[model samples]
Target: MRFRPSPATVAVASLLCLLVGLVYLAMQIRTVFSDQLKQEYAGLVLETVERAESARDQVRVWQQLPVDHPADASGYRTARAELARRLASLDALMNASPSAVPQVMSSALSADANLTDTDNLLSNASSYWRAQRDANSADVRVRTIHIARTLIALAALLFCMLVTAVGMYAKRNRLLAGQSFEFERASLHDPMTGLPNRRKLLAALEEAAATPAHQASIQKIAVLYIDLDGFKQVNDSLGHRAGDEFLIAVSVRFRESVRKADVVARIGGDEFAVLIRTFSTEEELADIARRLIACVANTDAQMGIGHVRASIGIASFPDLVDDYRRLVAAADDAMYHVKRSGKNGYAFVTAAGRSAVS
Candidate 1:
């Protein structure tokens, strides 16, 4: 006779699995939010650095003006004051940042000292400012990598949890008959947007990449990284309540814009990702990109947000890259390229080449 576990044993095991999964899910969500805060803080630091650079540039330009010129002297004084104010702000921001990088802190202090030293203002301030800016930029890059790794790990762990939960459910099906699995499904979706979350999107990518059927049938997998331009300005001007409304409206538009088979997800604040499993040619992808962009632009206008647009970067799988992380990174890099050149556009990244479409 085959030995079998008792129903009570299965019940206990199922409960234990559910509890573990919930705890892990909560921890992962907390980590994701924490990483987001870090990213935002880093963004604030970068913005401060840019403002400092601008003030420094203004001082330099004013210094070149004739020393005896009364208007030039007035402008120089104003620029110097502005630079000092900006430096104070930067210092305060650094102090407030929870994870302020040591190198960045040192650079900021050095830059402040150099800026304040009248004797070295012209001689060394520029160099100090540049050093601070570069250090902060490097810090941002490091933080980004850390966040990406955290997210990937979280996704993997969630996948494991899902598998365990499914197995347990299957084993206890008779005992727990008619029990709702809604909680499990809800954990994988975004609460606000009613769409798949980052964890779900990554899991889908992994599944598509691993499945032999997908490999045989799908011609290409395209990942489009979409970011809303001027979203911050809108949020600032219209308040966060309006901003939330805007996001909801845009999320709806995103869902409507994509095919039923494609996956659309809000990966971060004002950042979305679309995964297309089937596409015949580059033109097909381009058409989808254009439609998505138009959808966002039209929605922004309709919602009374002034002319917000999307900057998208497309990365194709197998043809351009094989790995999931690299594929996403390539798309992110291409999106930044569009942002740097001009907002409100799309670009494609592949092993062969890159092209931008406006």
Candidate 2:
């Protein structure tokens, strides 16, 4: 049977895929920018070379004039001065981009002692610059091809992510009407992982809230909202069967991590919630969160895939919120905060404020 992935898997995968695409896009942009700068520098050097060639021609023209001509001496001096300035600019360009232009040509041009013929020096310099420019153009073309391939890959990943999200959303919608509003004593559990469902979790929360403070045996009730990280990638790379197996394996770890009195439920796709009915100290809750994270983190070896992490949000009764009903939402929001700041960590929603765990 072809296994269908859950909406939570698609959603997390889409988000992470988008992030990867953005990073690749940014790197390509930087490469293109650097290439553009190189092209600009090459153009500047060539332009300087052209101007120097023009000045050399001017000097030659003045040299051919009659020695006794009225403006011959003055014109020749002016042309030579212009040629000297252009040569200096060309030398600077050559120094800046020594790798682009041939060193032999630059050295001969600078000395002007070896190449006595002005025309020969300018012709050789022009040829060398054009060759260098062509090479640079070829390199740019190759890089452009690589960038195009990357963009295409990015587009494909995004399109798949979107389709998966839509399909999962529709599947989620189909099951919405079947959800029971009031939690019944009859065993309401998740079929796939054999854990308690969202309805059962809510029922437990309602029961905890309904209990009178005077008769309450437990001092505090805390909810740990957990969302698995990197599960989407694992699902995509491995088959859906592997994904299901992975979830099952993780659920087992979660079940083992909590106390018999505590409730662990598969509330939604790729999301789990733990109802800690009682805890002696805040550290106890923190320890539970740590153990949960470690459980997921260790899945990499068992699943033979890359690392998988968890982000947890903790909301305690009378400590974070006065009402136990708001515990789930508050805890879910706190878990999202962990996702935003950075995944693979847990955070708490307390009366003082939200504080993240390392």
Candidate 3:
């Protein structure tokens, strides 16, 4: 028989591959952003250099005119001031940048003693500014090249992750379709209650969120955040083994309480989430909420678990919020609101406001 990796192994391997891909993508994004900033800075530096060159040309024109002429003297003074301003701006930019070219240019500028000596001063300053511009251009080009290469690598990594994830998903489906249904169930479902785990829940949520057409047809979607009341105390007092049994029992009740189309996921140790795809009347939703609470509250005494109930918060999409993340957050907030007031109840949050589900 051909050796096949277990579903658990495949899931873990896929997760690791995706994690690595995401990390590389994040690093590349940072590099690209950094390069863009450097390019903008280089452009500013070049602009300053152009201004300096223009000032030098003006100074040359002023120098050709007679110094005795009133207009000529005024023009020379204006050109000198403009040149000084441009030089100052260039120096500031160079100081801010990590380029050695700025220091070399500054030294060249300092060597020219006579500010009014147009020919020599203009020649030296032009050479230095040109050199600085060339250096900045070179640096920008190198950074652009690096960004391009990083982007290519990021694209490749993303492709690899996509392929790996798809393969894992197909393998999981195959396992589910085969005689190893129990093993596949163990891989995707929580071992305690056999309910779908957090990973499966998130995957389902993401899929629902990504399909706009499906969402539009559904009319509205709701995520109910559920927390077991007094679960921690039970785990503390009854011992962890008993707590586990209680959880498994509670999970069964939770599953039975919901509609066949609805999905109940155990997202955390004592937390659950219900993804309600079909939107009915508020009265119907409240009925389901009551059923879940009653189921948990009426646990059999033989289980040795004290009175444990559920605090449920319902947040609907396009009704409570459009964004999936905020919708979940709203549900969570409402759940906590119930918990704070007193546990063993449910609350509903809509775009209008939050209200207790009596």
Candidate 4:
């Protein structure tokens, strides 16, 4: 029979794989998001520079415009409205990263702040300058408008960069979650048999014990320790590869006989273990043992050598030894007894004494 990894081993491996993959993905996400933010921020800086130049010219023109010109009033009104719109855009950009905003955006906002103040001051001075028929109103207006326009473009750049960064981060998180899932699957299963390995079996046993008692009785936990007969002989006679295949076939047969709640594992080599919970009586336990023995009692080793049989030992918590260690030892001893007597059977420690069947 081909020996296979216990379910616990498979699970542990699967979980480990998933965890590592998730960590990798998380790291990737940080890199992706940061890079995206940096590139986007760089583009925004270019736009801000251009807009600032435009606003500067507008401010200068406003200052130079002949104050006596009737259109001066209308142009001033339009400049004021444009200034208000630019301020709103700047506020939006700064608000995006109250604490996390890029340094470039911060410097730009400060520069824009001076322009904002200039615009406010020009608004107040406009009325007076026009009354005095000043020649510089148009130039002042042109300069101020340039600054306002620059800040608006800067605000747009910052806002877009933040949005892109968030999107990249979110995508990376999703990738990490998927990797984690795969890791978990690796942690709890045997790679060969795809069964619950030793770790998973132990966990399942503990969980079963914690459930409500069956039929008003406390739950009973059983470990059936199985030793394949003539396993070594087969390894010696046939190639290890064939022996491995045989063990695998035996494992499949053994698993097919058990309920889903029951957990089975190959500890290593030719030894296997099955854990059962909530058996109502010894008879229930006996029936399970019989099923297992029948499953493994092959008439040949597939190559038609001698028969393949097994010795099974059962130990139960509370009835056998109290704790986990003793329980396993008791079951192991019983299994040995079965092997010593005759191969294809089971043995269990009972209050009456140890009992074995050939």
Candidate 5:
């Protein structure tokens, strides 16, 4: 059989997957935007580095100019203006890297205030800008790889969610088609012994009664109401936990004694009801009741409970009771008779001064 998860399990898992995927996707998108901003800053720094180099070349040209030449005055003023513009550009770029480059450049400019030696300052500024550019590039590369992996992981999560949705759809279809009713069955079943509860047993009786005689293979129905003997004493002596285990053990044996189509139900604490859907003769029903009694009687020594037996009351439809609804009540009354007149025995309901075969 194919495995099917419960509806609640699927719902919780889907919610968790969606929550985690959304949070991770949001973080990755934010990183992508931050990386873009860094790239822009790195580009601006590169432009500033070029401007600084050009300014350094211009300074060298001014230094080589003839000091006493006729064009020396004009050439000096033009070179000074160009150098000032480059310095302004470098200041703007310094914002991208901050404190270190700007502070070093300012100190160098002051030390070479006469413009006699600026190569050291320009070289230092260029080196700092190059370092900033390289660092930004490395960061972008690493973030790119990380974002790629994040996308792949998100894709995988999406695929898993798709598969889950498909499974949920298939499960829904199965339920609609009446192929599976585990949830419904669970509601109608005893959690302790995994047997049908009183509600399920009643429902089965109703369905059986509703069936047409021509459609139903077996037209007869019987109910056996069983009460455990000395069960309360076991609970009092060995504790409730042991009593519960003993009940489970007894239920298993009772289940084994019945046919596959028959239902064994736990109607109350220390009380059970079995539905016999098909039986050929009254003797067959007696043999089943005897087997059930033997099951409980033989289990006492093995469970260390010491002599716990069953007092069963049998009721059949169209024989003891006229109505199907009266079957359980009639059987319950017969069981009490056994309980009053010495427990650990079986009795059948009486009708018209005749006892239905035991």
Candidate 6:
């Protein structure tokens, strides 16, 4: 049969997608902020270089005029102010720099400081034509800032790819989880009957018995071992397809007749089991057994599905040795007694003898 996602699987997938999408969003935002910070720092570096160059040019003009000229002093003050502005820009970049970018920023700052020294030397030169123009260290710093900006761009690109990859992985895992649940459903459950198969039932029984009765925190356990009667004749005459439909109907009735907390399973073919709890008396046990018979008998009367009667047997804790091995043994023996006495009745073994229902 074709599979659809169960409600449980769908909810889990949605939660996973939401969490991954949120993580991806966080990554994108971080990259954007990183890029913006890098751009602002690059602009500040360029501004520093420009102001330093302008100050040196003014100093050159002052040297050409006169050492004692009023305009020469003004030119010197302007150069100094430009120098102060360059220093302020440098300080700001240093303060706001990311820890990861410290090495690059430190190297660039060294180059910028060397260029400022050159500008200061130009201001104090004795001869106008003998100004020394050495290596373009500040320009190299500017190129390095451009290279640092490229790092930001590259980081953003890589972050985008990383987010995309993680999102795809999350979606793939969600799909696989859904597929696993589908496989489990097909394996452990009888699709038409909606009851656990023999394998699953046996496993459940084993797990239950592995824990002590005291650990169960429950007292007085009761088991209803059920086998449907006249099922084969119905299948042989009405066809297997009709027989399946009948079994489905019977399965629904069987479930409805029991307490909600009971463990019900189709052991194989027409045999079923129910583990009912908290039955502290024989009357309480017999009540449930009678109800099971009534459910099948009424279902047969109403649906006419070829004698919808069930042979049921009951066994309880303490009386059945309070262990899985003995409890199953007691219920099985009672079920055999029910089958032999008369097919459409219920039985429970006692210390005296078997008690069979009329």
RMSD of 3: 25.0
lDDT score for candidate 6 against the true structure: 0.65
Model 2: residues >4 Å from true position, as ranges? 1-187, 212-219, 352-355
lDDT of 3 by residue, 1-358 (tens): 9989885786677577657756765765666566556656666776776787788788778878889978888888888777777777766777778645424244334323255443354455457655655665576576567657666765776776678778878977886788487766677788878899867776667666665663445456788889988788887887998888888887888888887877899987999888877676777777888888877776735565667778999887766677776766788888998898887888988576665654
> Residue 266, candidate 5: how far off, in angstroms?
0.6
Candidates in order, TM-scores: namely: 0.48, 0.47, 0.46, 0.51, 0.52, 0.55
- What clash pairs does model 3 have? none
Predicted structure with the largest TM-score when compared to the true one: 6
lDDT of predicted model 2: 0.80
Which candidate number maximizes lDDT?
A: 2
**lDDT (10s digit) by residue, model 5, range 1-358:** 9988787787788678768867876886677677567656767776776776687677678778777875886776677677766766666567546335544356444413545435665666667666766776677777678768777877887788788788889878987767457778778999888999999999999876675857744367899999999889998888999988988998999999998989999997999999998677767878888998998888898987676889999988767677889899998988888888888888888775233434
- Structure candidate 5, residue pairs in collision: none
lDDT of 3: 0.73
Q: How far is candidate 6 from the true structure (C-alpha RMSD, Å)?
A: 14.2
- Provide the lDDT at 229 for model 1: 93
- Give per-residue lDDT, candidate 6, residue 46: 51
List lDDT for all candidates, in order: 0.74, 0.80, 0.73, 0.65, 0.78, 0.65
| Residue lDDT tens for model 6, 131-241 | 111122344455456556555655655675567568767888999999999889779888779897766765665665554756755456667788888888878888888
Off by over 4 Å in 1: 1-180, 211-219, 352-357
Off by over 4 Å in 4: 1-187, 211-217, 298-306
TM-score of 6: 0.55
* Candidate 3 backbone clash number: 0
Per-residue lDDT tens digits for candidate 4, residues 1-358, read 9988664575565566556645655554555455445445434433443354455456567757876876896775566455445444544543453235322233333433456454443343334323322323343445445545545554555565566557657878888998887777678777666666777777777776664745575567888888888878888878888787777777887788888778888767888888886677767777888888777665243447676778888888767646654555677788988888977888887655475564
